[model samples]
Target: MFTPRTPRIVAARRLQRRRDRDQTGRFLAEGPQAVREALAADAVLELFATPAAIERYPDLAAQAPELSPVTDDALAALAETVQPQGLVAICEQNDVSIGEALAKEPRLVAVVAEIRDPGNAGTVLRTADAAGAGAVIFAGDAVDPYNGKCVRSSAGSLFHVDVVRSPLSVVDLLQDNGLQVLATSGTGEDDVDSLLDGGHLAPRTAWLFGSEAHGLPADLLSSADRRVRVPIYGGAESLNLAAAAAVCLYASARAQR
Candidate 1:
């Protein structure tokens, strides 16, 4: 077994389960993009990169002053993925509320409800960042935004976006702030395109999507101002939630532009 040079850091990584991370108010971001974004955003407390990964991304070393170049075994020891590479960073998680995020200078928001897939949630956040959304809201039963897998899947976009976690009250708060809380569902009168065509996409709208398997909770579904679906021509039952959210948010982006 390969031993860690920095025992304290290694011990912390070994102890960094989801609950431990939540309690400590810290999380790890894995991969080159994640580490770079964290450094660029000044969100990282510490950075750890391996020799090979550092060789591939020398700019990262130039960017973050407090980086540690360690062996691949050490980097792999801290990672949650099967193939951890490039870099990793420990950063403080944002404790801001969805209510606060809704109250900020954002016209577009992507609402993720009960989205169990880390890839879906991360992709939605990435899309929101690309769309210049004010915030990405993780409503009830959603996956943890700070999960290492989520951070990696986001492809560095997490650093540019405001991620919020909260209950359903923020939905009403969004409405009060001139936002239209539109949910995506199979049974809907108007499609997403119709809403966008009618110019409803610019009013600080919230594009709500659901989990892959269960969809949004029924109560939350009923609470939406509008239930809309994406029109499909292929034999697919539904577009992946991340793809759907991307389409919705980007459509809003194009409409606003």
Candidate 2:
């Protein structure tokens, strides 16, 4: 069993940092679900599991191209969670270029711009996949999609959807691809339901979502084809980023399908 101080274990632990992940072109995916998804995507480079985890998930171990039996202490050293799930896979960073993603002629897409919270970003990614979005673009200063919290929060959807990390102008890219760009804002001129009712959501669409603290920038909002708001019938002031994204993406999904 590999110990915490083992050379390979030490190297794997470094992946917890963004700099290391970027430099190595790899990231860590923890828990059985994430490991299974990474394996299915052919993104896993190496897998580390505790003896008990291997026994409990023999099928996962059997499928690994490379597996390392790690001591519980070593797993703890490598994991970011309070209770490590006993399995972690070192996987390749699979983000594609914005042009490449748009080349597929996706009907529905989500553009995450400067969203710093990993949980919110991950939830949006998972929601996009559930709503049948063809791609998700992490633009501007958005959080790393490979963040452990983001990966865990995505619940395996990260592997299922096309991911794009680009600093290019997303509005222009989507517009160039014949996708109508819609930005969500409290003071927006159009309502989501109104667009759906008018059959405007049937076309290829890309929903632009901004940071949790601040909504989309003025330039992006202006660049969007339409600024839309999700009508809230309740006393709630506003919906969080992930909730708002779900409402908007599903509206488009319903209209397009």
Candidate 3:
């Protein structure tokens, strides 16, 4: 079993930090489900697990010829969570460009702009994948997609969907590709349900969502092909970024079907 001081273990532990991940172009996938998905995506470069974890998921271990067994303390050191799940994999980055993602003619896409919360960002990624979105784009000043919290929150869906990070021109890029970029707002001109039922959620569509703290910027809202709002029948003030994304993405998914 590998000790905490092992060179490989030490290197993998460095991946928990954003700077190290950015420099190495690799990130850590924690837990059995995430590791399994990363392996399926062919993104895992190396697998590290505790002896118990390797024993519990022998099939997972079999898939990784480079599996290394480590002590429980070593596993915890590699994990970002309070309670480590005992399994972690060092994975190569998988982010693509906007043009590359659009080349495949995605029917539904989720465009996240300036979102800071890693958990929310990851949940959005997971939701987009579940809703059959062809891509999930992190635009503007968004959180790092490879952030450990983001990867963990995405469960296994990070591997299931194409993820992109655009510095600034995401809207322009989507529009140039003939996609209808629809921004969401609390007081949008069109109702989300109405658009869905009317079959107006365009075939080649991208749903634009803003950050958790603030909704979309005014210029962005005005620039969209259309501004849509999810109607609130109940007394809730508003939905959070993740919840709104799930609703909008699923709506587009059902419409496309």
Best by lDDT, which number?
2
Better of 2 and 3 by lDDT: 2
Ranked by TM-score from best down, the candidates are 2, 3, 1
Worst 10 residues of 3 by lDDT: 77-86
Query: In model 1, which regions exceed 4 Å deviation?
Result: 52-56
Q: Which wins on TM-score, candidate 2 or candidate 3?
A: 2
Q: Write the per-residue lDDT of candidate 2 for residues 37-127, one digit (tens) a residue.
A: 9999999999999999999999999999999999999999999987657998999999888888989999999999999999999999999
Cand. 2 TM to true fold: 0.98
- Worst lDDT window (10 residues) for model 2? 165-174
lDDT of each: 0.78, 0.93, 0.88
What would the C-alpha RMSD of candidate 3 be, to one decimal place? 1.2
Q: How much is 180 displaced in model 2, in angstroms?
A: 0.5
Q: Over all chains combined, what TM-score does candidate 1 have?
A: 0.91
Can you give the TM-score per candidate against the true fold? 0.91, 0.98, 0.96
Ranked by lDDT, top first: 2, 3, 1
